[model samples]
Target: MIPAAFDYKAPTTVEEALSAMAEAGDDGKVIAGGQSLLPVMRMRMNAPEVLIDLGKVSSLRGISDEGDSIRIGAMTTYQSVLDDASVKEHLVLLHKVVETIADPQIRHRGTLGGSVAHADPAGDVGAATLALEATMVIAGSGGEREVPASEFFKGLFDTAVDEGELLVALRFPKHTGWGAHYEKFVRVAHQWAIVAVAATVKADGGTISEARVAFTNMGDRPLRATSVEQALAGASATEDAVRQACASAADGTSPPSDLNGDADYRRSIAPVLTRRAVLAAAEA
Candidate 1:
């Protein structure tokens, strides 16, 4: 299979890209790195009339420190994330997850914004962003707008981005006063998660001051395990307490039963994975 014939535009500026997208309307699609989109296009899953390439837009690819957050350009590759000193010092959870995304080759081309925009439920970046409570910056014909991590993802293969909107960057809140870690369970060294968990725990003199738990591949979207977070609110940072809190991870989730594994298996493993993640984060 092959993508249908389409016009191509390499826009050097965000304003130009927005104008091109507005003109192309529903028949337009943006490509940055193209790690995932090209394969789907080759399979005929997406055949847009216009392909707007943002690869040459230098303004859309960089890492900078903002007042209260770290701004990562949409086209920043996963490998670059692994090497970013600011991200390593501030957003340690993301640093841990970037290494687990895929093999080196895939990491070299996969961008943070691309993963979030693609919104694959099983994607590590999506679940990590959810747990990190980040913000997504998007641009369109009208102007720029920020979408919260929780609201950015709508469902499997879907996002809050509207027509003519292109994701410009991701903003991760500072983790200066937090302890964080990311844990993923994959059958092989480089593969999609069987089930994954990301945990952020902030300590306040031996008591669990704050806790956040998020899951990957547990539903149609990357989700925060609110039940577990609520349960762990003020509990002692003990193994018993962590295990008990993890018990609530799959409470409201109708995890899919796909060819990878069954719903029962994912449900069963989610709590265990969450427990391990929380422990690692708490110890950090």
Candidate 2:
């Protein structure tokens, strides 16, 4: 398939990129990594009149530790993230989940901000950020504003990143010493998850003090399983207790049925994966 003809602009700075987007108005699309947008364009699903490329934007591509939180630039690649010592040491859940996204080549090219901005329900990174309660830093002509991960994803392929705005960085609160795990259910190697769970728990004296459970592909967007979190809090960090808590894994989800599996099948397997993820985190 061939995409429609469109104008393109490669900006080296945030200001230039924003100006380009403002000039193109609603007909422009900003591209970073091109992993998600290119495929959509080739299929004729989107035919933007102008394409603003952020490949040359140096400011949007690095990892910085800011005392209590880590700020990851929007254009930073997955491979870069996987290789960062700060992420591996403090944000272990994110480090574990990113290793499962696509393959090495895709990881080298795909950007974290791109995935978050794309807001794909099946994307692994979003669930981890949601579970960690990260913050999104958005930049536009009016200046910059921070949006919480919980309020960022509005629906399937939808987000709070409005027109003329760019996601510059993601700020994650440090989760040092927390036990974390990402449980992904895929049909084969290098495939998107049919259903995945991200679990992070803080345990004390063999009892769970706090827990954050998030699910991917369980709804129109990455969802926090509040019911499961509540069930696990204050419970013993044991397999039996984890299984009992995970029984409500699919209670509030609206999972989609596709070639991979039906809604009922996903619903039935949610608890299984949740239990596994929770137990792994507890044991870690």
| CA displacement after TM-score superposition, residue 63 of candidate 2 (Å) | 0.8
Off by over 4 Å in 1: none
Model 2 clashing residue pairs (backbone): none
lDDT of each: 0.89, 0.95
lDDT of 1 by residue, 117-230 (tens): 988888889888988899999887778999999999898889989887889999999887677878888878777898999888887877788888889998999999988888
Superposed Cα deviation of residue 208, candidate 1 (Å): 1.6
Clashing pairs in 1: none
Please write out the lDDT profile of model 2 over residues 1-284, one tens digit for every residue.
99999998999999999999999998999999999999999999999999999999999999999999999999999999999999999999999999999999999999999999999999999999999999999998899999999999999999999888999999999999889999999999988899999999888889998999999999999999999999999999998988998998999899999999999999999999999999899888
Which number leads on lDDT?
2
